[model samples]
Target: MHEQREFIPLDKEQTPMDTPKRTIWIQALKVAFPHTIPILAGFTFLGIAYGIFMHSLGFHAMYPFIISMVVFAGSMEFITANLLLGAFNPVYAFFLTIMVNARHLFYGISLLDTYKGIGKKKWYMIFGLCDESFAINQSIDVPKNVDKGLVMFFVTILNQIYWVVGATIGGVFGYLITFNTEGLEFVMTALFVVIFIEQWMKEDRHVSSLVGIAASVVCLLLFGKDTFIIPAMIAILGILTLARKPLEKGRVSVQ
Candidate 1:
């Protein structure tokens, strides 16, 4: 044959922008409006309680207004005034708050590889990985041509709105509101119980719940309430790590 050169063609499909980006703001509003209503309500109540407690402890409304902006954990915000007043030790507060919210560590790990290339948007998303955002992201099936980063961004924005509104308005509600807060702290425990029940219903894994309860009980009994969280987390992690091989071998659909 007359000399012919082989030619390779470039694949034109490599660029992501060729596909349409989903209406991120619209999808965000869709998810935020309905899903965030209850969040706003609960955080309002939580923040009101926090404001009342802080006021009772001789602090201004602005104390919670600021802390809620900075340390936005749902449960941790409630106890922070006490922790700060009792110890005034940032080190203790830091460890104690993280111990209480250690589950976020797992959430962060799950999201670590997924949030890549988020550009300047990465900073706030990391800070805003609160309970609601984690829950929303956990359930989403990333839509076609839509970015997870944007979803996370919207989730964070939505959550911060709720928290800020809660914090800023809580004092007004607190002063105008009069209710006995005796034992109301149980709301935090109840919230966790509800979340656990929801997760359990979604996943339908008896072993996970059993292991969690068992580890929590064992740690609480051994280490006492304040210090037990660290050990409980360790126990939970150890058991889950051990189950990884079996879970993978069995091929459960969980990510």
Candidate 2:
């Protein structure tokens, strides 16, 4: 009986309440992507090498793909490929994995404050906290408006995606490829060196850096390459813990 008004659908009339959440993700991805490009290159190369290694061992493509996603521990996964071919000893495997990944304990401790209050993201962040992710996330400076948690989340996921994709490609097509991969394995090591140099240049104080170098050299000489990592990690943690107060004081004074 009254004048007909143009009808608009309720679903299309207004934006969803979660628009801010979507915006946060988009913004975080934008910030996170550039930082991870180097890792993308490194991870892809190493992951393909790993997949090819597994394929050479006569493992199925699914093995490397699944291991890359589930294990996500770069060095340990390589060791695991060898372990799978040998005698089955859960105790040996367990201890060896712990020894290989013992550095993560230090990584976790250093990140406690940075990762605090990140809510559920903390879970996946921890899960995907590889060496490269740790370096980037620990040093990155996020924009004030964007969420740091989301930035870290994207970095972790993006790095993993690179690794997974590379591994899948190598696994699926490794047999068809015949080019030499002789020196490709060193790509990740080169990446680590680059990251270390970048961090060294960024900081004014070299105390921590010097301590790490000295400890590593000492441990490597004493324990040799195959067994040095755990000892070096232990030495670094002990020295850093004891010197925390002095380090903080020095940092404050410098500022």
Q: What is the TM-score of each candidate against the true structure?
A: 0.73, 0.85
Instruction: Give the per-residue lDDT digits (tens) of candidate 1, residues 140-206.
Output: 5555544556666776777777677766666545677766655654544565676777778877457
Q: Residue 130 CA error for candidate 2 (Å)?
A: 0.6
The models' CA-based lDDT, in order, is 0.69, 0.84
The sequence of per-residue lDDT tens digits that candidate 2 reaches over residues 206-237 is: 88888999999999999999999988988987
How far residue 245's Cα lies from its native spot in candidate 1, in Å, is: 2.4
> TM-score of model 2 relative to the true fold?
0.85
Backbone clash count for every predicted candidate, in the order shown: 0, 0
Lowest lDDT 10-mer window, candidate 2? Answer: 6-15
- Residue pair clashes in candidate 2: none
